[model samples]
Target: MSLINRLLLLLLACAAPLPATPSDLPLKVGLIGLDTSHVIAFTGLLNDKDNPSHVPGATVTAAYRGGSVDIPASINRVRGFTTTLTEKYGVRIYEDIAKMCEEVDAILLTSLDGRTHLEQVRPVLAAGKPVFIDKPVAGSLKDAVKIFQLAEDAGVPCFSSSSLRWYPGVVEVATADFGELRAALSYGPATSEPHHPSLFWYGIHAAEALFTVMGPGCQSVVATESSGAIVVTGKWNNERIGTLHGIRDGKTSFKVTAFGTKAIVEQKSGGNYAPMLREIVKFFQTGKPPVPAKLTLELYAFMEAADESVRQGGTPISIPDYLRRHGQTR
Candidate 1:
């Protein structure tokens, strides 16, 4: 037998067989968003009427609570989306999250703001189903940690991402064997979701790209905003340094660069969504979390603590103490 086959046999020698693709089977996917606009992308997907191209084999099937009623208008964007959702996806907006979770095998929680993720997603986790959270996973590091830990303990997978992370160049750089990567620089459009979570929600698109390639163990980070431009500097084990820029009105609208002692690589994969979805499908097939939930929580740890510093007159905060106080200093 070939070396590959022998290795595979040895690895799965006593493991259980994987599941058959319920790919073509009628899978029910629910979307939890106050504004139907969030689900509109999938609703009008490829003009196929069923979002067949992306979610192949699985049907979005049902969408609930197509409208937001209880939340204050100051925080709600659901009004503008009702018509599109009803006309495009035939989704019904329900008030109770428990009821919503019971009806679907999987959920797409696209709440209007990051602050609302914890309240909305907890029920979904308790229901024991997989979830895909749109960026800005949670409002705080503590909350993000709780969310992942809950899902982890429950054996329910949750994933969140940005299109930029999968851009061709970023993927290529990620494959590098950088020896002690000294620094990484990633740039993206001005984050519109800053009010809820400054660079917390959207910044991860760039941060996650770096975090993935860096392979975790980020010690702390500091960010400075000058005239609405965010300049983020971070350290990993106090050895390698990285920067992430969220700039407005910049012509060089996209870039991700990684550096090493022996090699350097640069690539630009701007605004790609297909890769994000493809990864999710892979997670379902393998029944595994898409990325290191622990690592993701750590990145959130950085963002949350950094934001606190920003609020405290640019004072630096130690993420380790914060995590340790919460008993999460892993």
Candidate 2:
């Protein structure tokens, strides 16, 4: 070949993009449920290379369509989400969670029904893979506690949370230089799903926001319910108070007010799932949970106490007492 031709070929080779090496490969993640919109949203951000907000180093490669057949909300939407994940994202659909776990490095338990989370997560934990359980970790507080306990026993890193906890404003409030927080109030919409507990369905968003600012150590909860709203007041171990307002009527938004020694801060949620997904990827890579198991348990206890308080006619329910009654201790 002519020298000029050889030089041209060399230049072309140099300009060509190199294939990604093993070290540069994205983590293969598996989704366990296709009943919720999160399955599509999360997969879109992780798998779409053209997305501006894409969090690199992870891709959802497979999913299992495990939806509750009895619940119309679950059964109705499963087919659409399943098709999107499979057709749009090129994600392989699995017949069961166990089979999907075998092919992925980590798991996302995104089942819409909290009642199925415990069973869905058992095999994943047995495989010793990290998992992120979506809100309403379980249908009841006892089941939620049991799921965490199983994860602990299996020595697998597992955590549950609502996306509301990672809202830009809410996160800023928790970490800002607002001095020691004396009290806090969080408000959000609460739409109940009859299959689960009243607050577990949608009120979890407000509860998560409240706990994000207040931290743990909720001593007791007093709840008052009416047609328009349900107000839950929690007293902390240190005597600090926090309240969650679950609005059932009119327009709704997620907002919080924190009263601190140095400054008072009011935060309005700018909802985005990318931030939390980034944290989830980090947790998978490191095998450490971003949120501790203890705090999550306490959060569920607070929600359960609120339900119990309403049942007892707006009386104050002790957190410790509620936990003990449910076969859990703090």
**What lDDT does the true structure give each of the candidates?**
0.67, 0.90
TM-score of 2: 0.93
After TM-score superposition, the amount by which residue 318's alpha carbon in candidate 1 deviates from its true location, in angstroms, is 2.8
Residues 90-171 of candidate 2: C-alpha lDDT, one tens digit per residue: 9998897888889999999999999999899999998888999998899899998899889988999999899878889998
Q: Write the per-residue lDDT of candidate 1 for residues 67-156, one digit (tens) a residue.
A: 334435423566556556666656666678788777777777776566677788888888887888877787667777777777777778
Candidate 1 positional error at 42, Å: 3.5
Task: Judge candidate 2 at residue 288 and give its lDDT.
Answer: 87
Q: In every candidate, how many clashes are there? A: 7, 0
List candidate 1 stretches off by more than 4 Å.
1-23, 34-37, 43-53, 66-76, 177-180, 192-195, 248-252, 311-316, 326-330
> Candidate 2: where is the Cα deviation over 4 Å?
1-21
